[model samples]
Target: MAQKAPWKTNRRKLDITPLLVTNHCPDNIWPGISTQSGTGPGQNGFQLKPGETKNQTVSEDWQGRVWGRTNCSFNHDGTASASGQGKACLSGDCNGALNCRVGGDVPVSLAEFTLDAGDGHTYYDISLVDGYNVPMAIVLQPLENITLDDIPPNLTNPSCQGTDGLLAPQGYNPYPEYPDFLRTNTSYPLPFDQDVDENKISRWCPWDLQQTPPEKPGDGVYPYPDDNIQRPQFNPCYSACAKNNQPQDCCTGKYNSPSACKPSEYSKNVKSVCPDAYSFAFDDQTSTFIIPSGAGFEVVFCPGARSTTILSTSRAEMLQLSQQGKVDKQATIGLKRASASKLRRNAASTTFRLDRTLLTVTVVLTVVASVHVFC
Candidate 1:
């Protein structure tokens, strides 16, 4: 048998859409403590500070962004489809007092043989929805040959690590043997050589450090006047499970939640210990590829305002073109112009005449021929 040329295989194009949203709010302020130790001079022997009566309202903005991608393949027989979706989210206060929460989800769908064009080309269509309440969406289309090697790897376990961990490496300096030490340090594992060609698969899970109980005043040096020696330190296991909304190990021997484990301290380490996971092709599997698909929308939020500006762009021109009558003429024209430029630059060596009449006639004939061949 003769070797086949790579270009001779069927070509496929993937389409994707993603959405994004953002919101902002102000910060909060609390009253300061009084410096006077004993009762102050007043009618009742304790006087209230002049300015302490009022409660100050600190304003803050909470901003969030969400997006998803979809992909589809084009069949020479006129039908085009593929399947892929990705989602990401970010939330935080504009004043920087509060920590940000980020998360991502990738959902995949597959379509079996739906259309067949014997011209060495098969068609698949994939669509994605962010499904979140935020005002954001994105679409992407990736073109490829129909060969099995052209399929991109799936992205699973997507995640986001907020800036809260900036102090983790230093603040949580326990030895590796400690469970909390492992939780803080065991970020997704990387290959020792950091080379894709390596065959080993590396993985890491978050662990928790064991909190040491505070020392009693009599057991150590004289405690400070304000020190609370008996104050309990938190237990790592109970703290972690609680913050995640998981079943608390409080009663179970396997996972115990002692009085020492404060919910506040437990919540502080959640994002740090739970970084996102990303899988990549090892060097040996470099033949793999990743194509993103989706329609994208940009929702910009102004300072101190709750409303935002929403703008949508094309993920695949075909999808946008299919919706021509539904969208504004200006949007359609812009998409058409952009699509024409992209096709000219990226399409295989074949030349497509774009003169209005000629292009319409050509497209009509191609569609008719495709229908007959597939039927």
Candidate 2:
């Protein structure tokens, strides 16, 4: 044998997928982007006007977060103000820059992604764990060969059932633990509650966690004293971690483990409203979603009663629900009340059985003692 040639192996290239962000809100919104892993696309931030849609691309192994910045006004040179008001975004401001070099400020509704995370799957979720600023949804775009059955159950679509008249689309599977308080508590403001005063009161966010406007007026960017502009008081809701910074709320220090750090009242309420989104740290079971990589996605702002064809449910039932409009308020309340009463009855029955068992044991002991005395 004169000579032997070395064998060569072929390496596969990573795929690039499209990410389309649509603004369905009435006003302008700036979509802020940040990369957490691998090589990012470098397109950090831009503005999307009402009804406008922007498209970006990401690598197969990319990991990042996207959020919307509301009521933003930047200088001609793309520099925002440092005053924390006006000339900057009311929520999700990236520290005086139109193009974010870092993650936006908290209380922003987050749509997070990690492509090719594990086992050739991509992971994503809508997170209100940091709190919520606007309604958002992450929908996997339909591909040529992929069908609803091919998609993973949790990875289909995660939409925030947020304020600003947003509702969970028909046939969308909500979190399993969706509480009845969301239906029966008259005090908990429903999305379609006509009596809600958006300007004066918070629609659904807790009063203590509501974000307040800047104390001083700005140079027309925010337009503080403009009576013509209708302002919403509860536009952004703050998380307990961001507002209080306690170890328990932030899941830090001794409360870092899942067992140690349980959901707070704030997290529970938020979870009830937006079950598809993460309500607190370590809320992985119900919030995180995973699917095989290689599909495009759409991030929709202010999604209304859109078709739930891509959801993991019957299309016909969804259509029927869409036609029926809002849920039956009276029926929902009655069902919740009945459920509570049944739980109470079960508890009482258990107590009664325990007492009867104890009485029988006492009588048996007394009879045994009398038999011994007679002998």
Candidate 3:
């Protein structure tokens, strides 16, 4: 028997929707991807500030995850150094640099993905097996085939059957024209179960991971236990049986099989909140789900429980807005034409404000650059 040739496999390049992220937290949290597979190995990892939106692209062959890093600050050395923003982080630190060259430090909540690989179905999941640092969620970018009808917590309504989800209102809407967003919302674990606001499941600091340190210590010294596991300092919510590494606890040795790896107290705690999420390593039955190719994905940190949209319910409001947009465009065009006409009409006599002149020049340059790039 002859082995299959390389080219025989469908080496199609599919564009997974660019990741668009919005940080709802007041404090800035860095978000990054540790892209491990595909031709773009070196081309992964970036940072985002609070309330900032970033658009990114990933290849179909890409295998990696998106995670949020908190309480990190950079220095002149380009390493994570002590600054007013603090150093490294409480969780999800990638070496010392902002761009993660490798996977981030563990105990992180993750939106993991393996695109166009293995069985070739786009696999995605929200993993609590590493333990949760921040409240996170991921939902499919609605394709044309699906409509945003499911009201959340009822996964079968729109039939996101095999996929992971908690049906809530669309948290983030990228396209105004495509307002009917169908997404999968995973149930948050533990303290993240409740809604902080109508829009979100839980606040970023659901419960302080570490006890507050009374130390008004010296420079570069942050408060609390950090990574130290001393008495009273260790996070009470830390993964109990799993972290302990016992066979019955972590589900190893004899308990390695799925049926044997029963949920321990800690695993049950996670399971209670996010019943569908991967609570442990062998919780693969409910953890993994597949999306079709060309479907977009967003791994949002601090995902709100609900989403709000600006699109009006009435046809009247939508019509008014539409007309207004057209009018605005026409007005802008007329103004540009008039300005150009004036410039040509009386080159010597006409006077234009410095600001207006600069604006005109800027618009012309923008148009030229756009043409250059697109054309």
The best candidate by TM-score is 2
> Compared with the true structure, what per-residue lDDT tens digits does model 2 show for residues 1-375?
001111111122324577878776555789998998866665788988756778788775778898998877787767766454554877898886899988888789998998665444456888888888877778775343232223232225655645643342222221222222112122221122112222322345654676763333344455534433443533688888988899999999999999999988778866656665788998876666554455567788765422121222223222222233112346445434543454344334432212211111111121222121101
Q: Which ten residues in a row have the lowest lDDT in candidate 3?
A: 155-164
- After superposition, which runs of candidate 3 have C-alpha atoms over 4 Å from their true positions? 1-17, 39-45, 83-87, 142-237, 306-375
Clashes of 2: 0
How do all models score by TM-score?
0.16, 0.63, 0.55
lDDT of 3 by residue, 223-258 (tens): 453422122211213454424557776777888887
Q: What TM-score quantifies how close candidate 1 is to the native fold?
A: 0.16
2 or 3, greater by lDDT: 2
The 10-residue segment of model 2 with minimum total lDDT is 357-366
Answer with 2 or 3, whichever has the higher TM-score: 2
Ranking by TM-score: 2, 3, 1
Query: Which consecutive 10 residues in model 1 have the weakest lDDT in total?
Result: 302-311
State how far residue 314 of model 2 sits from its true place (Å).
11
Mark the regions of model 1 whose C-alpha exceeds 4 Å error after superposition.
1-17, 20-91, 95-157, 160-290, 293-375
What is the Å distance of residue 364 in model 3 from its true position? 30
Question: Which candidate number maximizes lDDT?
Answer: 2
